[model samples]
Target: MSRLKEAQKSSKGAAAYSRYINRPLGRPMAATAYALRMTPTQVTIVSAVFTLTGVALIALLPPTVWSSILIAVLLVLGYALDSADGQLARLTGTGSLAGEWLDHFFDSIKLATIHLAVLVCWFRFFDLPDGWLLVPLVFAASANVFFFGIIAADFLRRVHRLEHPHGPAEAPREAWRSGGLYSLAVIPTDYGFLCLVFALLWWQPVFVGIYTALAVINVLMLLLAALRWYRSIRGLAADV
Candidate 1:
């Protein structure tokens, strides 16, 4: 297989847009990174630079036709680079615990700050009811919760596996999440889709409508996921 094909990750539980679009976009970028002898950590820093720059732009500049598109492009590129770092690590056998930590650290910062940047942008530029300003605040809280929940759940699962190496595998339960319908159903939660949404930032009303819809969907999804994750974690504790 080609290097790009070899670097591909399983798309089983990934959102539709991420599985179909972002990963594919990252493949060539990963290949390029590998060819350049770049470390995964370096690539991750580059991702952070792109992402943070876009976030800064959102807060610092009034949206314009051109600026909105630039923001979208920067975000999209940043997200693709986020995927590329992992692929590069996997391809080059350079994966390390520190590298993983750095990746998640940048991601946590991104998750915590992106919506705050939106809140800042709206405060500075958009003319809306004061009550409407709460949207990004709520969304920011939800995003952080979602990000932390996933990380915590994964850590707990790893600990459980270490404790019970021969326990029943999780594949059966995970199978449902791997399905195409599950992937499609979660597209609203995909960061790649959110990056694309920034392209409409110049249209304040449309942006607010879609952003509100996304915020609502994220809260609902996070609630459902929290319940499931709680049950799973409780079960793991019981098994210990």
Candidate 2:
């Protein structure tokens, strides 16, 4: 099997887009990193460089033929590096709590930064309605809040011996989330999909429509997940 196929075996689980697209695309790089004996944290720092570079371009540079294409490439590189870091960790058995925290912090900043960049982009150039700039801010909060909720649940679960702090939150086996057609569904929260939207900035109408739709989906999902988590862990909630 290819390195990607090997990496997939180690994937605990992921949303469809990550399972199908990002992982597969990142296998070769993961293999290369392993061959080079690179540490997971090193890969993460490199990934941050690529991600922040892409964000800088999208956030600061005006639309140009070359800028969009270059931004797309950088974002894709960042994503591949992101995938490789985890795989490298798993492959080398260097996956630590500290490393995981580092990775999540990087993702959190990148996530917030991208949305704010897009907000600026829209305000400066797009033909958007008044106050439409606030849409991205809402999406940013929704996504981050949902992420923090998951972390809180996982931490509380660990405290109560519900699961190990470092073990699988679900089952050991792959399921429907690993399916190929999941790309379409995962677009709602896929980092790559969001980058694609930025890359298509020349088409302001399409970007605005997609950005707003994604923002709404994120808010609804955040509420639904938070409610479900609260209900499921009501015992812990009461004790706290």
RMSD of each: 1.3, 3.8
Give me the displacement of residue 144 in model 2, in angstroms.
1.4
Native-to-model Cα distance after best TM-score fit, residue 20 in candidate 2, in Å: 0.6
Question: For every model in order, what is the number of clashing pairs?
Answer: 0, 0
Tens digit per residue, CA lDDT, model 1, 73-130: 9999999999999998888889999999999999999998899999999999999988
Angstrom error at residue 171, model 2:
9.3
* Model 1 per-residue lDDT at 110: 92
The 0-to-1 C-alpha lDDT of every candidate, in the order given, reads 0.92, 0.76
**TM agreement with the true structure for every prediction:** 0.96, 0.84
Q: Show where candidate 1 strays beyond 4 Å.
A: none
